[model samples]
Target chain A: MLKIHGIARSRAFRCIWAAEEAGLPYEVVPLGFAPGFKLERPLAINPNNKIPALEDGDLVLFESLAINLHIAAKAGAPLMPTGDDASRVMQWTLWTGTEVEAHVMRWGYNAYIKPEAERIASEAAAGKEALDLRLAVLERELAQRPYLVGNGFTVADLNLACVLYGPWLNGYDLAPFPKVKAWLDTCLTRPAALRARKLREG
Target chain B: MLKIHGIARSRAFRCIWAAEEAGLPYEVVPLGFAPGFKLERPLAINPNNKIPALEDGDLVLFESLAINLHIAAKAGAPLMPTGDDASRVMQWTLWTGTEVEAHVMRWGYNAYIKPEAERIASEAAAGKEALDLRLAVLERELAQRPYLVGNGFTVADLNLACVLYGPWLNGYDLAPFPKVKAWLDTCLTRPAALRARKLREG
Candidate 1:
């Protein structure tokens, strides 16, 4: 049995979706229980003390994206890439964590988390600008291809899609990005994605 | 010829060090005028317009740690773990990006980048608090082991070290962290690490 730590409303959701997609049974260890709860035991597995810790037998790993990669790898399915592009897949995955994710979190924190009175317009604008820049790059890459890597979907596309979902749900429109919008549509069409939505709707 | 795009002081140093450590023959395509510039280049390799994009033949990769991992993969040296621990290695490497890197960047912005007048006491304290928490966790982790993964140095150590170095230079006393300080000593003891320091000095 595998154990996962973190609330579903977090980056951990992606890991849960990944585990479900892989048909692997997993236990969701709640990090936020009471009002102010956040990563207590989960931090033991990961020094960062964030969320989405995965424990498989004697091995424990943290970081949502890394957990997704681990599960995808163990399942041995469509989640991973083939041939020499394995590292390329890994490269894009980390890129999402750096470029897309960093910006998205900034925007989300400012626009939604911070009270309107406390939120700085410049910070929000910077977040928007940063996300826009990232989307534009995504638009270009996803324009010619169905996914981030190739004709078919891979883990890179899945992870990137999840990152984009943050800003989109936070009220940032994706209307201008045709390629990105279309790519999102394709990702949403996946059976696993539908299940991911159902799991996240709470 | 492999062309790595990034400035010296940026996370690109990871790639710079990795290539040198891997003995990968490549050229440095320095972006940003000097050190610590966060400007972006539009519609190119990096969407967010950041430094440290790696262009190897036709494949273009960005994100410093990712590029470093790609280089490490090719070199297949003792720098990274092999076989079963590979993904585990990836997990820790990404953890550095997710936790240590972001937290330390906050501290750096306060110390060096932010104008003294604009520097808020609260912001610095908040940043310091976050760094203290993360570093405490790191110190605890290091107390148990020599490196982040397995018994050897990997990109996990490299990425975290580079990101955390900024804070250390800004006067966060590392003397009390016997485990962390000892581990840092071991890491910097490497000839490659010594050479990387030279690059920084120059």
Candidate 2:
């Protein structure tokens, strides 16, 4: 059985969601952010000491997006497209990480993660503005098509949806981008995502 | 023929290097950073108006690593590994972007891209420190092997080498991590990278 390290509350949730979507059996190692946890097992797997490290046979891998992509690829077919469509899927996946996720992280850290005294209103506002701009791009694209890549859902949607979950939970307004809002609604409600969300919340 | 838009000096160079490595015939659209350039053709393909967008037949894609991976996959074997090895390749590729490249971008922006008046010495110092820490990871990993994945060069090395190139050019010292320095030297010397570097310098 494949094993995943890290709590679902972290980016590891995406890996769990991917496993569920792929119908692959997986065991969660469940590392937490609690005191003394950082220097423990997670570090042994990932030098970065970040959540969401994966183990399969002799292979140990970190990075939630890579883990998700690997699971999707293993499952094959509709979960991971082929040829030109695969290129588009990769495009959206990378875009979500590089473009969308950074702004979300910025806004989220300021709005929730950072201590009140350290939070800068101006920086948070700028992050929100940047996020809105990126969201507008997604809104335009989603308005034209239901899914990010092909006519059906894939790991691209799963990865992107997980990134957006942060902003949504942080109470970022989704009103300006109705299509993106709808897309998120559709994505988050999927059985796999719902199971992952329950596991994360627990 | 495949088309890659953006100057070789930008992330687009990775796509060019990958195409050269894959032995795929490609054309360069040659975009510049001049004002108003962002609102033009680049936006038509990539809503973010970022360089390094790709067009192959009816498909359009962006994100340098993704483009490189796509090219390598199309080329197959040695350049792109399969199965568990492919997972490790993806892990390293994503790690380069999220961890290594961010610090490089930070230092580069402060050391070169930002105007001297706007540059922050403290932030640049922090970036350098962060970069050193990340490079240590690579140094330790590379000390064990010549390539990032498998026994030979792969897209993982190509992507990572391109990410490191910016910092290397900006005079970031590689002496502290001899293994990483040697690995990078090996990666950058490939004919494809040599061609890409020449195009970028011109």
Candidate 3:
């Protein structure tokens, strides 16, 4: 059986959602960080010691976004696509990781996740400010299409949506980007995404 | 021919290197930023207004790493591989983007790129400190293998090496991780990489 190592509440959430979307059966190994942000235990599969590593028989893979792509490809699902669509999938996935994830993460931690006294107001505001410009780009793209890649839902949508989830849940306003807001709403309510959300937030 | 829309000095350096390594004929369209860190003009290819967007026929792609992967794949060379090796390529590509690029860029800017008056000492120090732990992970992996996947130079190495170029040039000291230093030396000295560097630096 395929095994995904890490808690659903972590980046493993994206992988779990992808697996569900691909209709692939998998188990969560529950690896995570201990106090002081160290891994709970050494993970031979990933020297980086970060979680959401995937074990598919003898092949081990790390990076939640990469893992989701592998899961989707293995299932031969539309979530991964092929040819030019696959290239588009990769484009959006990398863009989300490099451009969107960090800002959204900073905003989420300061705005909702951290203890009230520990939060940095400036950090939260800066994150939101950075996100505003990127959201405008997303708004333009989504205004033309319902999903990131080709017409149907794909891992691109899944990856980007999962990164945006933090901001959406933390009350980051989407009032200025109606197309992004509508696309995000549609993405978050997918049956597979809801199933993963249950595991993460239940 | 592929039209790479960006200056060689930007993230386009990675794509240029990849195209060279893949032995593909491509043109550089020379899109770049104006003062105030904005694109010199609007880029319909990338709504984010980032450079390093790729145009091949009617297909357009942004994200330097993703574009490199596409170039390598189109060439059908060892740099892209296929099957499991392709997955490993994606793994390392995403890992470099997520775990290494930002820290290295921050360190690079504060250490060398930024003018003395604009440099932030604390930012450079913090970036280096964070990189130390991640470098240990890279050291372990490099100690075990000459290359990231399937015993050859691939886009994985290309993607990662390009990201590390900033720090390497700024003298971030890879001495503590000899294996990483050795691997990086081999990667950066490749004729294709040298060609790209000439364009970027000249």
Q: List the residue pairs that clash in candidate 2.
A: none
Question: 1 or 3: which has the higher lDDT?
Answer: 3
Residues B139-175, candidate 3: write the lDDT tens digits: 9888878998888899999999899888877688888
User: Scoring only the second chain, what is candidate 3's TM-score?
Assistant: 0.95
lDDT of 2 at A14: 90
Error of 3 at A157 (Å): 0.3
Task: Name the candidate, 1 or 3, with the larger TM-score value.
Answer: 3
lDDT of 1 by residue, B74-147 (tens): 87757766655777777877777766666676766776767888776676677778777767877888888788
Q: Write the per-residue lDDT of candidate 2 for residues A85-166, one digit (tens) a residue.
A: 8878777887877777778888888887789999988888888999998898899889888999889999999989998998
Higher-scoring candidate on DockQ, 1 or 2? 2
> If you assessed candidate 3 against the hidden native complex, which CAPRI class would it receive?
high
- How close to the true structure is residue A48 of candidate 2, measured as C-alpha lDDT? 79
Candidate 3 regions exceeding 4 Å error are A33-39, B33-39
- The predicted structure with the larger DockQ, 2 or 3, is 3
Q: Residue A188 lDDT in model 1?
A: 62
Candidate lDDT (C-alpha), each: 0.74, 0.86, 0.88
Model 2 stretches astray by more than 4 angstroms: A34-42, A115-118, B34-42, B115-118
* Per-residue C-alpha lDDT of model 2 across residues B1-202, encoded as one tens digit per residue: 8899887767888899999999999998877574445426537878778888889888788888999888999899989999998888888888877788878888888888898999998888889999999898888788878888978999999989999998876778888998988888888888888998998776
Top lDDT prediction, candidate number: 3
| Per-candidate DockQ vs. reference | 0.58, 0.77, 0.82
